[model samples]
Target: MILSWRKKRAARRAAKKQNLEVTSNMELTIPSHFRCPISLELMKDPVTLSTGITYDRDSIEKWIEAGNSICPVTNQVLRSFEPVPNHTLRMMIQDWCVEKRSYGIERIPTPRIPISSYEVSEILSGIQTAKDQQDAERCREMVLKIKELAKDSERNKRCISANGTGGVLAAAFKTFSKVPFEQNVALLEEILSALITISPLDGEAKSYLGSDSSLHCMVWFLKNGNLSGRRNSVLALIEIVSSDQQKIDELLEIGGAIEALVKLMKEPISPSTTKASLLLMYHIVSNPPSSANSKVIARLTEMELVKILFEMLVDCEKSICEKALGVLDEVCSYDEGMEKAYGNALTVPVLVKKLLRISDLATQFSVSILWKLCKNDKSEGGDVLVEALQLGAFQKLLLLLQVGSTDGTKEKTTELMKLMNVYRDRAECTDSLDFKNLKRSY
Candidate 1:
């Protein structure tokens, strides 16, 4: 490896001495205009940004996809990322490659024209035509074409997502969902695969996707479909419902939605699946229709969500732990829910461990959860109090006070300290306290 590295470095030095163009380690002596600004390589698919800078399609597309709004070369904020292909420059590069074959340069093949919105419109129209003619084979073929288009290039995926393909596919999903799953499995799968590729849908696309029939379709998949399908359903629903109370109510109206969520939580198919499901449930339970939140809590409690949350909290990631804690805090607001929370052997210990350990939000939720538990425990040598004390909950609560928290969390911590301090020496609580950090707490 060392010898190979030395040989390559020597070759690059000789190429510079001979005045051959060398931008990359591979030492391709290409013209300046033939190389992409972002990748600084021979442009196979050169695309010009509105900023008048050309970059390789894959490189610039990745930049835009990562949420960069400024052109890489110009550093100007992009109003829109409608990159046009530099066909003339591409031909020049190809011709130069052919002339330099003896120099070990390969001719670049003509790249396929990116799928346009007009082509996408035609494909959508063909699917509608097939549906109207009751041509199942033609409809499936059209849908499959769309599925393939979504995978062809990032450019194509953007076209399908932004140029009304999502809305068209959503309408088709509703229609195909009516057909028995066994009968329309292929067609439905194709539509869903394409939609998922371009999903977290926006504008009128999500509006159509939030339909009742669509919710039912996703719920069916959540309950009966394969792991991949179930995972997509959860992910799709995350975008569909968002914070829309009406859509959430419609999803809740579907009989099996929450039940399927619980079942999926129990035997989570994948980590992303589990996180998405937790996020969806948090949204649903937290935003129940006005006057119906209590009922929502009761429903979730009956589903054993408290137990599920306790199990999930054992050494989970910070974000997942934060969400689970958020939901558990809400569930514990119900009288029976709080009892079930600390009642679990794992709940109190997990709560204490995460008290000051995770993010500020998780710490807030953990404090709320522990406070609820201790407030409701009136028994002598209360299990909640004793268990918390043995786990060093007494010292942790004191530390939390000095570490600074939201006023509400600090108040709750102070309350918990007072409750636990009764079981400890009066001087012990104040003796070990870090007065400097405590002074900063004020």
Candidate 2:
């Protein structure tokens, strides 16, 4: 009986020791497993699961809120926990943004053409070769080829350079002009025909023929061809002439070209076409050929070019009206003899009408032309000046003068003042009673 009791007591002690060891291991392992990898802290706000596993609510919430529900250490996803802490995740995102901003990194859009050193060197070599060649015919052919290859290169360079367009056109013109006379003529004709056939291409090719080169080409065609043969060719060429005053003067010197352009203007066409033709005619007439001014003026007056110009000035199309006024401005700059030839055409009344009908620039140009007419001190213009004052032209002129004073239209404003004084002085003795008052009103 004694041996049995002793054995049972010893078994009971061993069982208690084993249960304690198991409990101790469980406590250490559970707490360590639930701890956050990032925070490296004991888990808090403990939560129990169906699988008999327990985890801190704060740690699980953080894991889910970070867009990383998986535990970093064990790689076990903790998706079955309670709601994530949104406020904490927002703070973390803000901190991440601040860290990125401190690095001075920015996302920039990429450019279309990423030019490199090798490509640039190749383009420079081609340009130099094109520029150095002396044979115009060979150079011309090469230039066209170079232009095709450099189209993209030019586009990329234009982003960083201002003279890119001029540089390209200059290279092309130099090549085209160096060809032999006969060859150049053929090339010019080809260019013109191409321009006509592909009307849309003209806008892009305009820079190809520099204004000076185009003027020379037109003169060449006009001088080489018979009057009838040249008529249509010159008419087409007229559309390309630059509106620059010097270029217009140069073009007017060509034989028979002016008359051809004037005839085209009189025909039925679109307003833009008619306007261009009229402008060319006006420049030609105003500048006149250097020699035999009287003969040219007589022919021009007989042709009634002044009447056509006045009618165009009153056209409803704003562009037509503006261009017509520009033409009138040029014409009135002619010498006294030309003015006399124009006197019989009754230009002032039409000009006065333009003043009220057009916009500011047109009005300014028309008034300028009127001032030029009066500056010649002709008796016919004196009568017109008196009529103008009666038509309230002086009042509008004075108002423009006042506005011009503040706007710094020094030249225009001074011209207006001079005109007002001229009208006042000229109309003093006239029978027009309004002019007499206008003389005193200012």
Clash count of each predicted structure: 0, 2
lDDT of 1: 0.79
| Error of model 2, residue 97, in angstroms | 39
Write candidate 1's Cα lDDT for 248-306 as tens digits: 88888888889999888888778888898998988887774346777777788888888
| Model 1, C-alpha of 8: deviation from truth (Å) | 26
TM-score of each: 0.76, 0.43
Q: lDDT per prediction?
A: 0.79, 0.52
Candidate 1's displacement at residue 147, Å, is: 2.9
| lDDT digits (tens) for residues 16-57 of candidate 2 | 788766654553322344344446553433443333344444
Model 1, TM vs. native: 0.76
Clashes by residue pair, model 2: 136-178, 136-179
Regions of candidate 2 where Cα sits further than 4 Å from its true position: 1-190, 196-254, 281-299, 336-346, 405-442
Clashing pairs in 1: none
RMSD of each: 8.1, 24.7
* Candidate 2: residue 210 Cα off by (Å): 9.4
Model 1 residue 70 lDDT score:
99
